[model samples]
Target chain A: GESVGLHLPTLSVQEGDNSIINCAYSNSASDYFIWYKQESGKGPQFIIDIRSNMDKRQGQRVTVLLNKTVKHLSLQIAATQPGDSAVYFCAETFPGNQFYFGTGTSLTVIP
Target chain B: EAGVAQSPRYKIIEKRQSVAFWCNPISGHATLYWYQQILGQGPKLLIQFQNNGVVDDSQLPKDRFSAERLKGVDSTLKIQPAKLEDSAVYLCASSLFGRSYNEQFFGPGTRLTVL
Candidate 1:
């Protein structure tokens, strides 16, 4: 079955440094992708999203790069902070609004 | 605005037991979704409802899992004769409309432990 996957299960970065999380999806028909942040004991919170038509989208201090040709997605956080410590997941949406999520990547920001 | 709401933050039940979880989506949202997230894994969509009508339930375990979004507002997910693999966090999410580009707001989730 087609699925979404992450490149790394965990990552560690010094506070104030930048961080990048990578994800790969198998479904080429997917039209939309999103990045979510989940703190311990909480549900995922939307961070940013991009459509297949676009190659990049940016939010406050965060950027989502989509490589439709390779079916790859990446999230970049500038000047990572302690609050950025959480698990990040990438999701792809099919035509009917059904979303498929990847095995999350845990990001640890050290002070 | 309030985010998605769910009940009974945690539950522990033995295998073969029955359990139910509830969710209240953001007001006026017409699309509701139920997802199962196992520890160390991402959330997997189990079902989706569009204004009280099921739009997709392909991944739902129909033999033991069922859901309904009565009145297109609050929804419930029930699992009968639960199995150990059913132990996971059930998350409820909603979007303004059932569109692939719309953002989905998620709830805190209900954690279930099947003993």
Candidate 2:
């Protein structure tokens, strides 16, 4: 069975500090992975995505690292802000566009 | 360009009652998706369509859930005889297919409560 899981269900970080959230996917065939940020009363928004061909990708103060050997993915947020407090989810796509999502990690940025 | 649009920010109904939600994706986007997101959980794909053709509905509970994307534009999802566990936010998203990298644009979801 294919599964993507987060190491932490919840995390707290200071507003000015960097925060890292980790995820592990069981399927080796998952060629594409993405991180999404979802705030309260809204839908999940795309954060960043990395293909298996690359080990790392960066976007606007965010980076996604993929470790195929360990089948792990991580999202790093620089300078966490109060607005960054939201649930983060990792999703993987295989042969098709259909994506499977992980449980999600709720992030709380304390000011 | 407008983002995906969903109606009725919230809905509440009793079990066995019927409900429906509407979604209008960005114009000319060939792919549309509907997802169910429970509290404290990630969104689950309930149905997907590519130009009015069903791409995937494997996880959709067909017995109670049905979705249609007529004319490859706006879409709707209906639940007949709802269940207590059906309480969740329904999200709609769209992506331009055949592009180099397809990134979906999401709309504010519709929260549903079942009694």
Candidate 3:
């Protein structure tokens, strides 16, 4: 079955440094991708999103890079903060507005 | 603007018991979604509603799970004769429209523990 997967299950980063999380999706037909942050005991929060036609999109202190050829996506956060500690998930949208999510990458920001 | 809202933040029930979760999407949002997220994993879409009409439910465990969105505003997800594996966080999300390009706003979620 086609699925989205993360390269690393856990990541630890020093505060004030940059952090990167990677994801690989198997579906070639997917046209939209999103990154979400889920804090403990909370639902996933929308972070950033990129369209297949665009290779990169940037937001406040965050960037999403999409590589259609390899079906790879990456999320980059600058000046990592303790509040950034959480599980991050990458999702691909299929037809009918259905989304498929990867397992997740747990990010821990050390102060 | 107010975000999505869900009720009964936490629930604990023995296997075979029934449980129900509720959600109210953002005002005037025409699309609603329900997802199940187990610990250490990402959320899995269970069902989707477009203005009180079901659009997709292929991933839903029809034998034990059911959902309804009455009046195209509030929705409920029900699980009957639950199993231990059913334990997970039920998340509700909504978007302005049912399109791949629309961003979905999520609720806090309901944590369900089935013993």
Candidate 4:
């Protein structure tokens, strides 16, 4: 079955540095992608999203880069803070309303 | 505005027991979704409802899992004869129009532990 997957399961970065998380998806029919941040004991919070038609999209300190040709997506965060520590997931939506989520990457910002 | 709401932040039940979780989506949102999140993994969609009608439930374990949105406002998910693998956090989310491009607002989630 087609799925979305992350290259790394855990990442540790120093505060004030930049962080990047990578995701690879198999379904080419997917037209929309979203990045979500989930904190401890909380639900996923929307961070940013990019449409297939666009190559990149930016929101605040977060940027989402989409590579349709390679079916790869990346999320970059600048000036990483301790609050940024959490699990991040990348989700893809195809023709149907259903969304497929990646395994997720846990980002830890060390102070 | 209030975010998505769920009840009983945590639950502990033995295997083969029955359990139910409730969710109330954001006001005026027409699309409701239920997802299961196992530790160390992302949330997986269990079922989706569009204004009181089911739009998708392909991943839901129909044999033991059932969900319904009676008035298109609040919903409930039930699991009968729960298995150990069924122990996980259940999250409810909602979007404005049930559109593919719309953003989904999620709740805090209900954590279930099956002994």
lDDT of 2 by residue, B27-109 (tens): 98999999999987778989989999998899999999999998999999999999999999999999998232578889999
Clashes of each: 0, 0, 0, 0
Per-residue C-alpha lDDT of model 3 across residues A51-105, encoded as one tens digit per residue: 8989999999999999999999999999999999999999998656589999999
User: Counting only residues 3 or more apart in sequence or on different chains, how many pairs clash (N, Cα, C under 3 Å) in candidate 2?
Assistant: 0
Model 1 off-target regions past 4 Å? none
Which scores greater on lDDT, model 1 or model 2? 1
Candidate 2 local Cα displacement, residue B56, angstroms: 0.5
Candidate 2, position A34, lDDT: 87
Query: What ranges in model 2 sit over 4 Å off?
Result: B98-101
TM-score of each: 0.98, 0.97, 0.98, 0.98
- Candidate order (lDDT): 1, 4, 3, 2
lDDT by residue (tens digit), candidate 1, B2-108: 99999989999999999999999999999999999999999998999999999989999999999999999999999998999999999999999998889999999
Score chain B of each candidate by TM-score.
Answer: 0.99, 0.96, 0.99, 0.98
Docking class of 2: medium
lDDT of 1 at A55: 97
On the 0 to 100 scale, the lDDT of residue A94 in model 1 is 74
Model 2 Cα lDDT, one tens digit per residue, A2-104? 5889999999999999999999998888898889999888888999999999999999999999999999999999999999999999998877747878999
For A72-110, candidate 1 gives per-residue lDDT tens digits of 999999999999999999999878658889999999999
RMSD of each: 0.8, 1.3, 0.9, 0.8
Whole-model Cα lDDT of every candidate shown, in order: 0.96, 0.92, 0.95, 0.95
lDDT (Cα, 0-100) at B79 in candidate 2: 97
